[model samples]
Target: MPDLPSGAVTFLFTDIEGSTRLVKQLRDRYAEVLAEHQRLLRAAFAAHGGHEVDTQGDSFFVAFASARDALLAAVEGQVALLSHPWPEGVQIKVRMGLHTGQAVATGGRYTGLAVHRAARIGAAGHGGQILVSQAAQTLLEDEEEDLHVFLRDLGEQRLKDLDRPVRL
Candidate 1:
């Protein structure tokens, strides 16, 4: 098993936007493009103390011990993707979300509202956008990092199947 936090953790979720259309548009070389994307993402994640949780196609779920590391990983991942030479001249954009909460990790799986909420926040974002929960924002404020993190308040948003609107 990877050295993931078993209790309190911050989750980062990422998804590729318009992946289906990109695949259709880039056809033969889409696989190579995606491979490069995954590689870049993994490198950024690893560099910033992130633990790989799950990844499918053009999405990734990662866990971090601190909000600082998680947020930095997200920002650096975006920077890397923007600078990569995408194959076949195809452009790609990704959305990311983060939420800090306690979760149960057993047998290599994470189950809890934190994870679900994180995924929903990611889904609600536009390509190249990052959405972070209020909990994560608080964590950010509590920790000082060398790199600055800036966020635009989205206010409380009603998320899919969530009981209360989450502050994003």
Candidate 2:
């Protein structure tokens, strides 16, 4: 495990919407949709040069070398999932968040406020929406046309366990 550079790294967090309810309702059917969702996300992330850091049930934590790639991957993932048909009684909506900041890398994993902030931002987004931190927004500010298609600013939010509010 090596320490990360002092500069900035991008983190992306995503979660499946209504996953618990859908699991309860679909029972056996949930497995199929979940598998498909995983496949799509993995492919899109790999294609966009994003590295998968961790996964917990229906949620994913990934890292990218740049904010642009992370945001693009998130947007593409949502679009891909939206275009797919789900199994009967199953819905596959996802909420994603991206943030760029200094982080520590150890044991092949990333840690620090940036990762936590990304998770919080993802939680703040609605299903099918992509939310980004102020740091990420700043990076994409000049690429309005490229960003307008998927990312949206939900404004500043006070995240749990953090002192100050983070813009998303």
Candidate 3:
């Protein structure tokens, strides 16, 4: 296992939307598609210095030490997924969410509201969309224009079980 991120960390969570439908449609071929999807996403995330924290079914939970790296990994992962040619021309859309906050790392797992908030943020997004919390966005404010990405104001979104709405 790789070293996990600690303290102030930016997390990237991703889930394949309508995955059960995909499984029904693809059947046995679904495994191949899933493997390729994971490969692409893992490659993209690793390239941006992301550590694979966990994978639950068709969802991935990754951690990054840098806020910019987390966002960049999300973009790269999305682009890779979009560009991949799936078996039988099937399209796989994954939703991602990013958040930056302090968390406690224990026994190779993270425990804190920040972790829950990050998961909720990812759960609230639609496929192909990368939703970023205001905290993560703020951390990227000092980034260079060379990053070549736009952070559109998406207003505030209320995540599941969260007390307050998070600006995206």
lDDT of each: 0.89, 0.83, 0.91
Rank by TM-score (best first): 3, 1, 2
lDDT by residue for model 1 over 1-168, one digit each (tens)?
675687779999999999999989988888988998999999999999898999998999999998888899999999999988776567889999999999998888899988999889888898888899999998787554455766778999999999999999
List runs of model 3 lying over 4 Å from the truth. Answer: none
Q: Is candidate 1 or candidate 3 better by lDDT?
A: 3
Task: State how far residue 38 of model 1 sits from its true place (Å).
Answer: 0.1
Ranking by lDDT: 3, 1, 2
lDDT digits (tens) for residues 1-168 of candidate 3: 777889999999999999999999999888988989999999999899998889988999999998999999999999999988776658899999999999988778888999999999999899999999999999888783768888888999888899999998
- Name the weakest run of 10 consecutive residues (lDDT summed) in model 1: 141-150
Q: Global CA lDDT of candidate 2, please? A: 0.83
Candidate 2 per-residue lDDT, tens place, 1-168, comes to 233333588888999988999888888878887889999998888888888888999999988888888878887898889888876555688998888988888777887888888888888888888888999888888886866654566677898888899987
The candidate 3 region of ten consecutive residues with least summed lDDT is 141-150
In order, what is each prediction's RMSD in angstroms?
A: 1.4, 2.3, 1.1
Q: What is the TM-score (0 to 1) of candidate 3?
A: 0.96
What count of clashes does model 3 give?
A: 0
TM-score of each: 0.95, 0.91, 0.96
In the predicted model 1, the residue pairs found to clash are none
**Candidate 1 global CA lDDT score:** 0.89
